[model samples]
Target: MSSRTLPLLFINLGGEMLYILDQRLRAQNIPTDKAKKVMNDIITTMFNKKFLEELFKPQELYSKKALRTVFDRLAHASIMRLNQASMDKLYDLMTMAFKYQVLLCPRPKDLLLVSFNHMDAIKDFVRDAPSILNQVDETYRQLIEMYTALSGGEFQLIRQTLLVFFQDMHIRVSIFLKDKVQNSNGRFVLPTSGPVPCGTQIPGMIRMFSCTGEEVRRLQFPSGGGYTGALREGSFQMFGERVIKLGTNMYSVSRPVETHMSGTAKNSAQHRPAHQQC
Candidate 1:
């Protein structure tokens, strides 16, 4: 294999170490036929370094001598790169660590590096124009479902994964929104005291906040009602509105009103607050 391929191979191997061995790796720049050859070379390098010795060492006695020896050896070569076999072993160890909450092994940076490397293929796959939109949409849908599932099932790992997932999605959405906004002439204004005509496309700023569970309530006044005057008061009321829960903590919709009034009283008050007060 060409020397140029070695870096990519290492990256791919490191990615595999992160426990994200998905089909996306097939989309990498390296041709499918050469992946195994590159992986084998990496494996050979890891094996020569005796990296697997510590992993295989006996833990039955847990003596200070054994612990000190292991620590000394690790201190000497703590940051060695892995070959395919070692990477596979690392993956197994990580899974077990997460499953059993084992003591510190790999650092968080190591795990994050592996995750980014593994995602390289997915990034490349979605970069293609034909699949970009579909991939982005599907990713968002998957995130929502994953969030709901993790929240309901109390899966800690899934919850942690969702945190990463949402963070990545937020970056993607920011990029997408910037591009969309730059191409359009209009600006986003948070709706105040009026009905948005049906079919009004929601802006990205609103959508981003909505996805993160921010409550957006729209209030409308009757025809011949004061617009600008009511708007100033309505804006204040918006801040105090109670968020209405729709279904089981998964969905919610809020309606803003003055704190003292019921929905009907609030609606009526909006039209004739002075008369009601009188």
Candidate 2:
């Protein structure tokens, strides 16, 4: 078999379509000399069908309008026993198709938001077993990075998603810490300071939660938007101050005011005293 026939091994490995094509070719009693030509044609047709299915599949997240022409070219190239040059072109087309899909049918923000809402779930998994949390944090971080790359660093949405995701994660981490401490008989207490180790912003928080941090940093904030580091720090300080003031006011007003009433019965005595003086 020639080096070119190596790819055909994939056909032998349960490609029913190729089997049917082989059977049809044999039925025609074609000469051995023409069999390669016939097989090549059959492979081309099969590849075209596969490409079409891939392009038009119901779950295909890309926009058909943006990718139809590219798909057509790729399908045709795959069918024609194209050379490596053509195959490389087909790969480029696939890349473009993926990009167009991302641009045209951007994923719903809710998909990410929902994940954030389950931050506690991730934390619980970690708390039950540190390995579980580690795995989840790694997986979630990768997903965040993938989504950010796909969105080309438009991070406002990504940041919003992360915030919600982390908030849920924080609640879960707190729960996990409480559970661990309670179950450990005074043997374990989560660390109280320093950067969290599991993608969590708070200690005992999963630090791997924001895998897209690098991508997020690359994101350009809107015009007039200041550095994210400064903004986040300033916002946090402002929020803390507000909370402190609110707490103080609440404490001062929490108690009820006291009042007293007294009765005086000296009116007649006072009049007698005044008359004696007169």
Candidate 3:
């Protein structure tokens, strides 16, 4: 497990939370000013310099209950509040959405791109508020400086750590089910074929190399699923088009946020240790 996993985890999950909240705010007919304040306040709290300082420190990921507590505070940073049931649903949706994004990444290094997509949305959330936007930009610079320098192996370690953290969580979400991206059992459906990761070749060819480092023979076979060459790599700088769209907000007025906990999650909640109950 990598010590660097927490920041990505937090940012992506926070992004999911924002998406849900934004949609709900609209659905509930929240006053425009009040809705804006809710987004600004949450974004401000999320990107707080002091909080980010602690978040960026090398450390183990928090326990599930502990992490929920952190978001509980952020969700209420403004006058907006959520009941216990609503908060529980929000958390379930956030985790499952991020887990799907992580599992769907074509290459481990693309995780940074996913995080950037989230950051882009976050910056947009407070775009009208210069002060809040500045705060978010600070964290964006920090993310770029910290994660972009990491090697593929380092990213794989971080991805593995996240997978470990999410293992056995199979909460059924209505959006995922409706889109057929998640199965009835709450597992995300991974595509068998698509454009390969940027900077990678399509799978199907094999080349045998000689001892002298010469290509001796080549073989080609059907690469099932109709794969294609990868698109150009997305920008890794502080600002540019992040071609990969895994982390972008999926919720909208047409597709409102909805979640239905799977039996597995419900059972876990019922039998959870008293200390672990959120």
In candidate 2, clashing pairs total 12
- TM-score ranking from best to worst? 3, 1, 2
Candidate 1 TM-score versus the reference? 0.19
Model 3, residue 96: distance off in Å is 0.4
In angstroms, give how far residue 218 of model 2 lies from its true place.
Answer: 38
C-alpha lDDT of all candidate models, in order: 0.27, 0.29, 0.85
What would the per-residue lDDT of candidate 2 be over residues 7-119, giving only the tens digit for each residue?
A: 11111111222222233334444443343343343334433444533422223133334433443342332112333443344333233222221222222322233233233
Model 3, TM vs. native: 0.90
Candidate 1 Cα deviation (angstroms), residue 165? 21
Model 2 is weakest, by summed lDDT over 10 consecutive residues, at 242-251
**lDDT per residue as tens, model 3, 46-130:** 8888999999999999999999999989887765657677889999999998999999998999999999999999888888999
Better of 1 and 2 by TM-score: 1
Q: Cα deviation of 32 in candidate 1 (Å)? A: 10
Off by over 4 Å in 1: 1-87, 93-121, 124-126, 129-137, 148-278
**Most lDDT-accurate candidate:** 3
List TM-score per model, in order. Answer: 0.19, 0.18, 0.90
Locate the minimum summed-lDDT window of 10 residues in model 3. Answer: 269-278
Judged by TM-score, which candidate is best? 3
Judged by whole-model lDDT over C-alpha atoms, candidate 3 comes out at 0.85
